[model samples]
Target: MTFAAQVAMFSKLAEEKGMVNSLEGNLSVIDRQTGNIYITPSHRAKCLLTEEEICIVNPQGEQIGGTGKKSSEFFLHEAAYKARPDVGAVVHCHTPYLSAYAFAYRDFETPKDTFLSQIFGNIKCLPYGAHGTHEIHQGIEEALDGRPVALLGGHGVVCVGEDLEDAIGIMEAAENYAKTIAIKHKLF
Candidate 1:
């Protein structure tokens, strides 16, 4: 599928999973062949995204192509891609359950749930960093050294994968994992 189609699909998925409310999350895909990156615009609702609103930027986070302002968290995407060549897409979302765990849990490894274990092997929590700041990007890079996903302390979750679908799947699995943990804790 085209990058725009993938972004739209993931955006809807984010909304369905309540990972984002209004315009809270962003999605990006990198063209491995061209070193180009396609991403959702800043401040646009994930559920209401459009092709024209997507921004295509270079690996350096420059506006090489596309419409609309790039996401303020573009550096986070850049850092992840730069750190992991296998990563084709990156998702940053305020998935409630995951975010809750991020603030509450210090070392949240893969959940006991089979689906979570299969999808997101483990979730590392990066130290708190200012949103959209260089510190946030740096924190992500350090946390993702060899991991596919990381939770930003008191902020949100970032998932990277070989493709957009995989990245989105990781995000979904993370939220489910967090929800399962919450339910289990309540039951105790």
Candidate 2:
């Protein structure tokens, strides 16, 4: 599947899994061959997102293709791609369990589960930043420091992976892990 299609599909999956609402998340995949970034558009419903609505931007964040404007949170994707050359895709969402931690300004501690601990190493909640501003991306690299997922303080979660499937899987795992923590604390 094309990167655009993959993004559109996983975006819908995110919505179906309660990772994001219709207009509340963004997903992007960097074409390994072209270096073009295909991302979800701003102000669109993920549940109904289509491949045609995907926007393309160069590595420098300039629009080079597609009809819709790039997402306002494009800078976060840019930072992740720049910081981690191995990352081919990014998934950002306001999942209820994870966002609860963001709202509380709390970081996650990897549970005793061996697999979860290996996959997620104590996700950090970066300091709050104003959306659509550079402030929102400040310290993002450090927050992502060798980790696939990071929580944007008072914002949401951002995850990176080698590809669209990998990114989406990481997002699902992260959300489920957060839910486990919430259940443990009776926060649900």
lDDT of 2 by residue, 120-156 (tens): 8889888889987777767778878888999888999
lDDT for predicted candidate 2 compared with the true structure: 0.85
Off by over 4 Å in 1: 111-115, 139-142
Across 1-188, the per-residue lDDT of candidate 1 in tens digits comes to: 77767776777777777776556888889888888888888777777777767788875668876677888888888878887887899988887788886787464676566765765666778877788887775566666767778888877888899887788777787677778888898998
The estimated TM-scores of all candidates read: 0.87, 0.92
Model number with the top TM-score? 2
Error of 1 at 104 (Å): 3.3
